[model samples]
Target: MGSINKTDLCWGDNYNLTEWYCNASNSIASKTYNCPYGCPYFAYACKKQNDVCVDSDGGKNWNVKGSITFANSTRTDHCSEISTGPVLVEYYCDDYGRIMEAYNTNCACNEGKCTDYFPICVDSDGGIDYFTGGQVTTSTSTIKDFCGNQLYNYTYESYCDDFGNANYKTYSCPNGPCSLVNGSGQCPSTTSTTGNVIYDLFKKVKIAGKVIQGIIS
Candidate 1:
């Protein structure tokens, strides 16, 4: 007859047993038997609360947006929540956890974020001008009116509106009933027969004759 010794080990819902027999000189032989399912001695302990569990490896809680459930324990898992409002400017975090800022142009005009209007006018007579609150003279030009004696210079002014449309004020010869000046700054006689007129005509005829002679030579 021999004395038999047995020991049982339990770990993580798994069990194992070992048996030993003593020999004559009090020496023992032992054999270990494993359960059908292997016993895991180093199983991690996770405490679940509020339907959420802590990651055994990273030791971080996993949360998801809305009622969605997160299965994997990867660090790349994240949640996205969207909020809507009439915001002129906004700031948020990206997927890479970067803080970014953005502007809403739809609300920009409503928020009075606009630049001042600078009014400009292009005249119909191929001239350009700028206008402020009142009228301004933009250009001047000389002209002759009826009776061939209204020699005068005219000034042009522009009237502008907020919409940038411009209207020009027209001007006419201010000096009338004036005589025409010759090349020598002398007023020629309007009468048909005068000594100065006859002398001028004769001088023009002599100049023409000299030009014809030079051309022939």
Candidate 2:
């Protein structure tokens, strides 16, 4: 907003506002003037002196790289974030409690935030497909699994696929309807029915397998 000593209004970043002022002839008049600071912006620029600078997420959406955190301070200017390629926004408070913004090109705009180091490929779950709590991940090469709240009797998985793309999957316990798969409540064991008997093959330790050579040197 660029409304000075008037009741009219205008919108945009650093836009000129026309104001009705008294000239030397002492008559009501109109003259358009520009603000040296910034226009009241729903734009990135701060509009007025009392304008505040804040990050609702505390910069949580920005990627964390090279020990960098997206943050603002009450003290000196901070090279806070990036809007495009390598350009970064430096936010500062003028002596009058006015928030001003500047730009810095001398930055490593990794993942759209200023960082001391570049990003690295990462899997927060240590390459495991399924995880509890949150599946922490980072990188330009790695991605996170998409799923809703974990379902009961359901096993989730994440891993690379045959064609080399990442994959996330959910599976029901047991091949058929989920049954008590031992006590761990997971799937892996199979059950079969013989003539007049029904027995849990996995519990019997009667699985078919052959031991190979010892651990390699």
User: Which numbered prediction scores highest in lDDT against the true structure?
Assistant: 2
Measured by TM-score, how close is model 2 to the native structure?
Answer: 0.25
In model 2, the runs with Cα more than 4 Å from the true position are: 1-10, 13-16, 19-22, 25-113, 117-123, 131-134, 137-153, 157-169, 172-217
Task: Show where candidate 1 strays beyond 4 Å.
Answer: 1-112, 121-153, 173-217
Number of colliding residue pairs in each model: 0, 3
Clashing pairs for model 1 are none
Cα RMSD for predicted model 1: 32.3
The count of backbone overlaps in candidate 2 is 3
Candidate 1's error at 126, in angstroms?
19
Clashing pairs in 2: 1-40, 40-47, 129-158
